[model samples]
Target: DAGITQSPRYKITETGRQVTLMCHQTWSHSYMFWYRQDLGHGLRLIYYSAAADITDKGEVPDGYVVSRSKTENFPLTLESATRSQTSVYFCASSIVISYNEQFFGPGTRLTVL
Candidate 1:
């Protein structure tokens, strides 16, 4: 089945350390986004890319970086993992930026101690 996948579904790390969350999509959607889901704050966009080599920051991009060297992959890296940044990260893809059909990966649960 062609869909999106996230590696290391669960991860544990310490503050000040770096952690990278990987996201891959087989559908080849033009738009991809990295979002963090936390309690009280349903979901917050961290970053997004329109195509390969083209990316931009979203609502909450601090302490995070994203790159799309290939259309199939969009990896989110937390340069300095913090306890407050601990949340379930989700990668989603869609044909457009509007409210259209989007496919999401299982999610990566990251815990920072």
Candidate 2:
């Protein structure tokens, strides 16, 4: 059984373009998160959802958007892709909000030129 997965393991987009990263998990976890990892900034949360249709902004959410319509899938979209947004993106899921281990997917490396 596949635990978690991400689409387009690598992507390249030009500035001003729109890009969407897809994430899916076999487990029906209640909490899902989107994070971006960069050289200087480390891993920063972009957005997260507690349950289906219940979403909230995270630490850095300026250029990114996320939606969770189903328990197994969460997708992140870049409204207007920018060079500054180039980073490795990861998707994670947890059974609960606290005191639970999160299972992460293979990251998607996005390069905005």
Candidate 3:
């Protein structure tokens, strides 16, 4: 997609299972990000990739992993899903590192049983 696309728009999984959420964009944007919104409230950054193979931890990255093998794709994985990990995961892209208007995907709502 030219803008952004996320898989599993809605999901339900049991606790301790490994789940990977995919995000892809065609803009070749410089920055990509993953955030989780709980109860449709605050969006907390989980991980971000500046470019291919260049990723860093964000505010809530303990249970998440992200990788960018190409400039247009960034995927987020949860090593072991926990109850607290259930939330609406959003993928965003930006042209810069600063406060540029971030473009967000529809989002993936994950539930932990």
Best by lDDT: 2
- Taken over the whole model, the C-alpha lDDT of each candidate is 0.94, 0.95, 0.92
- Residue-level lDDT of model 3, residues 1-113, one tens digit each, is 36899998999999999999999988889999999998656999999988899999999999888888899899999989999998999999999989788999999999999
Poorest 10 consecutive residues of model 2 by lDDT?
63-72
Which digits, one per residue and each the tens of the lDDT, describe model 2 over residues 1-113?
A: 89999998999999999899999999999999999999988889999999999999999999888889899999999989999999999999999989999999999999999
Provide the clash count, candidate 2: 0
**Candidate 1 off by > 4 Å:** none
Global fold similarity of model 3 (TM-score): 0.94
RMSD of each: 0.8, 0.7, 1.3
**TM-score of the candidate numbered 1?**
0.97
Best TM-score among the predictions, by candidate number: 2
Q: What TM-score against the true fold does each predicted structure earn?
A: 0.97, 0.97, 0.94
**Candidate 2 residue spans exceeding 4 A from truth:** none
Candidate 1 vs candidate 3: the lDDT winner is 1
Candidate 3 residue pairs in clash (backbone atoms < 3 Å): none
Candidate 3 residue-wise lDDT at 22? 92
